[model samples]
Target: MLLPPKDSVLRQASFTNFWISRILSSTSFQMLSVAIGWQMYALTHDAFSLGFVGLAQFIPMVLLTFVVGHAADRFDRRKIVCLCQLIEGGIAALLLVGNMAGWLGREQILLAAAILGACRAFEGPSSSALLPQLVPKHILQQAIAWSTSAGQTAQILGPSLGGLLYSLGASCVYGAATIALLTAGILTCFIRVERSERKTEPVSLRSVFLGLEFVYRHPAILGTISLDLFAVLLGGATALLPIFAQDILHTGPWGLGLMRTAPAVGALLMSLILAYYPLQRAVGLKLFAALAVFGLATMLFAISTNLVVSLVALLLTGASDVVSVVIRSSLVQLQTPDEMRGRVNAVNSLFIGTSNQLGEFESGVLAGFIGPVPAAFLGGLGTIAVAGLWMYLFPSLRRLRSLSES
Candidate 1:
């Protein structure tokens, strides 16, 4: 049997460094999330306030998507990623200081989140576009799987560690996040990639929307991206997890940490499996099936009051999501032209950021009005509905058999 693709990809120094940086950066972000969620809930004791956190981040990313995508295509992606990490580190430091001095109000946290979102708007496209440059075409799928696994591992560690540190003090969690983010930035600086070759063609309105045009033209890509967008946009249950931890589960920070980590555990396991085995046949059918499972699992989580049951449901949700992620990511990277990868990825990032951050906002608002449990239940149904709708509308997506086929 062949050695796992992860092992092969890791043999290259650049890929290894990039992988390490991913782990560190993901860890920092995860820690920051726990700290922010706990602190915000403690301060305001309102569900809407939690939603506002997502809103604060989402607005800047949406506003800056076009420019950030352009910059990624036009500039050195590594440098852009490094700079973004540095800025995120600064934000973590600010949070640390504010928490220590007791002046970090809800507004200040939201402001920091907005700035961090702006940095990520640039960072997401650049970092995503840089991946294909790191490894051979044959191992790209493995690389994506392993990279996601590393992120999932960080998500597992970060939340638990963050929650434990929160018990010490919110400032302690922020302090740890600051260190992790700065370390990631430093590691990113060591990655060596050639500068992007600039196109001789002058910039024009058409050039600006090229990524959008590509996705519009390719129904397969469009189907997959939009499928995830609408599904997660309506179905994401993460925003109301704090409420679930506190009121529904009747667990404290420790329980909250477990809740956060459960999905990652599932995702990490699934990613490892795909890394070794890979998907060979019936890829599209598998993708749709996984999404349907994710929706069902989410619905299970919504109604469960038992911690163990909720954890299991969340684990299944993460496991199901990994299949979709691996397939979708491969399609996006492999199908896109190198020159347009950055812009296309930026558009994809916009969908992702919208699904995540805006999804959180929607969850919070709905939870405030309708209650957390019902909100989650409704979201799950919406997810299921999207899967069915997309299955009917995008027969091309359903018929997709392999990444290599695209």
Candidate 2:
């Protein structure tokens, strides 16, 4: 009798296609962000506006979280993701035309940002839920690791490429982004997966709240998810990089691109290592340790005047972050059933979005009141505190020894 191929997810055709799609989409998203951030800062020259960019995207994510989660559970996730990429591609084209025609303003940018946020609200949950369908159960953790590596690869390219393209013009960046997103859309369309039987439960508050309850009831899953939520919420300093690049680092758009790229570099390297080696033991202790390192790295970046030092600090943050990410993601997926992945992942997505977008807003507000340096310093300190607190609050998480520990 014929048998399936070896254990590597890379050998699976569907998984390969999924990984490629993720890389393309992630790269396009990163490039788009670089353009939006630099353009917003250039137009408004204010920290609050930068913060507002995050808020604009975040608001839609918050409002649609339940609906999108339900849609992922009930609909064809591939189609949902494909539709989002296509719409985002069109949005990029609109930005391109608007920029070239001199009609793009802060409002237009914010509007596009809001639309993209809504699209991601659907895309993030569906894509995450689709992963387990592509690989065998035994190799799922490796698949998650590889998937992270794909995103990091995109991050490595996206910011630098976006920054470089921006020098030519914002239009150049937008045009390239449009093409990348369109290609990603097409790629997503071809990805194949054996989806779980769709949940036919009528849309209701009870159904929508199921994911939240599922997460809350599972202490380990809740711990990992909340751990990431709070850690990133406190440690996120990415929103301030444009300011750091232009003002403190004494660099231009190109420098900002590199600064944005630094963490991805660290993350990609770490993810690749994890993909090959995989985490074997003391996973819980490692998660907290990574958070501590990430916090320390954030603190270092905040205080550094030299660009090189800052980049190094950022790199450490990324490397440490992926360790926590791989562990958390693996645990969440393994713990949840296929039928529940969509809703559960949606809840997870909300926490992630909240941490990232809210963190940006918080950073901007804090930076506005005090200064970027003090604001970032405090954020790092806050992240460390969250780590310590979570250890005590979720001893189950702290005691976790493996992703499959059950």
Across 1-406, the per-residue lDDT of candidate 2 in tens digits comes to: 0114554443376677778888888888888988998999999899999978878877888899878888888888889999999999999999999999989999999999999989988898899988887777777778888999998898788877888999999999999989988988998888877756665888788998888999999999999899898889888999899999889999888788778778989999999888878888889999999999999999999999999999999999999999988988898889987777888988988888778877888888899999999989999999899999999999998998888887
Q: Any idea what lDDT model 2 has? A: 0.87
Model 2: residues with Cα > 4 Å off, grouped in runs: 1-4, 7-11, 36-54, 97-110, 239-257, 302-306, 364-375
Worst 10 contiguous positions by lDDT, candidate 1:
1-10
C-alpha TM-score for every candidate? 0.85, 0.87
Residue 152 lDDT in candidate 2: 89
Best by TM-score: 2
TM-score of 1: 0.85
RMSD of each: 3.6, 3.6
Worst lDDT 10-window in candidate 2: 1-10
Best candidate according to lDDT: 2
Query: Which stretches of model 1 miss by more than 4 angstroms?
Result: 1-11, 36-53, 94-111, 169-171, 194-200, 240-256, 303-306, 361-378
